[model samples]
Target: MVEPRPDQKKGLKERCPELLEIARLVSWCMNRDYLIRSCLDHINRRLGMRARCVLKEKEQLKLHCWLGEYECRMEQMPICKESIVWKVVEEGIPVNLTETHQCEGYSHTLGEKVKIKAIVPLWYADQVTQEEKRVGALIVDSGKMGMPVSDEDFEYLKVVGELIGAAIGKAELTEQFIDSYKRKEIMVRETAHAFRNRIAAIGGFSRRIAELARDKDLANEAKMIYHEVQLLESHLEQFEKYL
Candidate 1:
């Protein structure tokens, strides 16, 4: 494993903008798929590497985003203890490898041999357990047989992983919140509809009482009730527009 050193200030300066842009994405991006795709694009484009993202679902590692050299048809694969993905994902460690084919379950992740690969995991807290857990992994294939991936690239990838994990996690949570809110809005609309019907019924009865009442005071009271019902109905209609 190679450690990331910030020895070159120029390189760090150049990457600062990318990191800031990714941070903005993390803060505001609400769509899970779009956030992952956009983050992978930044990593691949800036580093000139083929990258892919894998997410954990139902105890299986599934491919979520691919920015590879060729088309991808492969899908989900079981998580083995020995696979590089598990090393990074379950253990919360990043690994830079020279021969990815030697790693167990490499074929399931990417169908071809990668000259060099950097794998980093995305971690999140479990909603029920409240324990820290990994959500996914980000893999970047860089360099050729002769050149090897740069140390600077590895450092940049490490930084990218730290933020990307949170961005993806937040996006997922945002989606869940939106779905829950929509369901509540539907319930509100239904309840409001029922209340509006009751108001209309009361208004009709009040109007009838006013028409039949012989006493002026009784008729005036009925008309007041009818007028109040009309105002309430109007207010309910305006409130429903928000939901």
Candidate 2:
């Protein structure tokens, strides 16, 4: 392994706080998009390089999030023959470079220089399957001078990217569970309501029977039904308070 320059080592040291905060975000932040955006902003601001990530959705690679003036010009990156994003995600390796050059997806013009930087693969730690899944690519934007982002920064980005991907996947799963639970809860409540309505009908009919019936046996049965229904309704009302 090549030794990082003193400046590079210092850069990594300074990024410790950012890394910790990113980890916190991953664990606790409910808003997945905000977490991703915050992480990218931290990378760009601390490292002086722009960053974005694109994950594969079906057959197409779509931009997930980006932070750079150049990125604003394009809605999404092209995944054609020249796309560097496609290669890195497919191969699972960083296009280690000492100098920046124009490449697809990561390409952008600044003054007269075309700056396209290296990309590192992002992996998500699947909670359900307990597997590390290669999910996306971290795209870097070379600075105005067209200098390549250091390998150390690439490593840092990969670490944070992994967290981001996992958090996003987890958030999606949580949302799905919430929606499913809500649907089931509604069904149960509706069923309870219908059951209560039927009980109320029985109570009403029993009360009328008790009032009108002359036969002692029938009147007694009607009164018992009405009293039992009232007791059942009291229990149901208590349960419904929780709902």
Top-scoring candidate (lDDT): 1
> Whole-model Cα lDDT per candidate?
0.74, 0.72
C-alpha TM-scores of all predictions: 0.73, 0.77
* lDDT digits (tens) for residues 58-111 of candidate 2: 777777787866623555644443465676777777664555433524532223
Candidate 1 residue lDDT tens string, 43-160:
6666666778888887787777777455445455554445667667878988877654556454434445453677888887756577776888888874343234566777888888
**10 residues in a row with least lDDT, candidate 2:** 104-113
| lDDT computed for candidate 1 | 0.74
Clash counts per candidate, in order, are: 0, 0
Task: List candidate 1 stretches off by more than 4 Å.
Answer: 1-14, 24-31, 70-82, 99-108, 113-116, 124-133, 143-151, 214-217
Supply candidate 1's per-residue lDDT for 128.
57
User: What are the runs in model 2 whose C-alpha is more than 4 Å off?
Assistant: 1-14, 56-59, 76-82, 90-116, 131-135
Model 1: residue 204 alpha-carbon error in angstroms: 2.1
